[model samples]
Target: RARPGLRVDAMVLSGGGGEREQEEHAALTAFCPGAELRLTVLKLADGRLPAQWEEAKAAVEDLRARTEPDLVLAPRTDDAHQDHRGLAKLMTTAFRDHLVLGYEIAKWDGDLGRPAAYQPLPAHIAEEKVRLLQEHYPSQRHRPWYDREAFLGLARIRGIECHARYAEAFAVTKLTLDLGD
Candidate 1:
């Protein structure tokens, strides 16, 4: 709604083409009805992305060959999850010209860190986000941190930083500003 004609192309690199992947597709569809979503699972074993580095790199390289995204949302390089860290490293190399924002995933590893950028969300949108997370991803319901409180708490803290009711934060390793003369 913010950008009426915003074009979104999402690539799921580590998905295993299982129930979880299906749920992810459904969630994305529910969240952004018109966005284009591409799922190209490398079929690598979960949590073993580092071990399959070559394959992962190849898959990302293929994605870069096909599309040139204006902005890329990737995992943080310092993320504790091997898969996220591997992909984060690749994003820097693959989309060197694009503005790549590293997104943090709340996990048991407790790797959340200070972010350099934030996008404020309205109360209705924030509440809807929590609802979608719970409703679409039934597979994640078992995790203790996968509840409403955890999601809302983080959003509230981020919102306080940006003076909004709710917000999402991103870690930016590099930025090039153009101050037109």
Candidate 2:
């Protein structure tokens, strides 16, 4: 979870190209009240392909150039969704020296891979996260796999992997520890 005092900035690349984009904005605003939110709604006509990989990469590169954040959270490279995979791969180049955490999004594609990092969530925080997702994205609720069970079930599985009651998993391609810095 992002601490309230921390400055959090998020860039939402695609948003299903409609009301979902607006819903995402609203949800993110509520989730990170004081954080900076950037939404780029692109036309992804094909679910399996992105509009333009070079353009998306350039956009992300611009964001990185401007923000130069200490950490970046992006979609996992092996995500079943091609759009996500493309962005994830591009992120590796954009934030080459930064700590990037690849987040997993549960979907019907069922492409969950073994994650190397675990961020344990408190019971209440996990419940709240599920509740927020359900509340914020009414359009996604119609999907069979978008229910609480799927969300909580994946969290539970990840928790088991990390020896916690509830947790979120991330793929870490690289990391640098400055223990004595």
Candidate 3:
């Protein structure tokens, strides 16, 4: 059966600042051009982890109630940060049937684990991905780990794991495979 087209809903449970959030939204739009986009901006502070958990979880549940998504890109449950882990748990709870791909955020904490799945990107597309991040998210350029080399290097490493030229990795708790009947 032919599936529905892409409709992506990105939930920014907590943002660092207004400018950062704007940059992030622009970057996401550039990356996923032509997709129906629904973005929720929650400007909760990092210090307020407890509050963020309840509010973000409730928002996720509410969104899931109204929309049926084919795929969900969320933070993994093994995420080092409290906010990310909490959000991942809630996303898993809310999206039991849907395909939930838990993505990674490479940071200094050394939390990168062996991802369970991989999606290969073509050479041109992978190059474009790095270019978009550098162009759209200028605010993040100051960060030590935000350079193009760092981004491409990680993609290369993940690609090596999956035997692709470039790839994004994800943690999958459960997946149903359909062998040809």
Candidate 4:
């Protein structure tokens, strides 16, 4: 359950490809049949993203040409992984008009770029979220928690800046606000 003031309308999966993506999409849909989640599997060949940067860009451009959303969430360019950086730039170029936010998965060195928005979770929620990640992403069972928790912990710590107990971080590309004043 979310906080009293929090609300989630829909979930969209972007830039996931390969067996892991397919399996995760199926499981997500099954777990939340009524959630109306749209999982779009980008054509990039998984770990081969850096080698096919232009292709990924074209795929995102196609996504932009076909659909539009008020906001877009993508991988943070701060990542050490070239794939993450490519996807981040691709999303930024494709959804130029929407709020494109980046989500980080902590990597070596100083997580590349900095993020601006943080979405906090309760300690309990954070633990549960990590559990879910471990359970669903068995392919990552071998990797150390630093790759995962470091990311979430950053969110939690960043959230603390905004008075949240725990949270997720995002980098926005564009944002529009209505001035009621």
Best by TM-score: 1
Model 4 agreement with the true structure over 1-181: per-residue lDDT tens digits: 2233322232222436566676677656544445556556655555677778777677677777777675677787556777777778777877777787888776455664566787767787777666566666677677665445665677567778779877777776667777999
lDDT leader: 1
Which ten residues in a row are the worst by lDDT in model 1? 1-10
Cα deviation at 111, candidate 3, in Å, is: 1.8
lDDT of each: 0.85, 0.82, 0.82, 0.65
Candidate 3 vs. true structure, TM-score: 0.88
Q: Give the per-residue lDDT of model 1 (tens digit) for 88-170.
A: 99988999888999997888877899999999999888999999999998988999789999999999999999999899999
* Per-residue accuracy of model 3 over 1-181 as CA lDDT, tens digit each: 0123467787776674687688768877887777777777777786566666777778888889878987888889889988888888888889999888999887767679889999988888789888988899786678888888887888999999999989999999778778988
User: 10-51 in candidate 2: lDDT tens per residue?
Assistant: 666656568877887788877777775665555544464465
Looking at model 4, how many pairs of residues clash?
A: 8
Structure candidate 1, residue pairs in collision = none
Q: How many clashing pairs per prediction, in order?
A: 0, 0, 0, 8
- Quote the lDDT for 117 in model 1: 97
Clashes of 2: 0
lDDT at 93 for candidate 4? 77
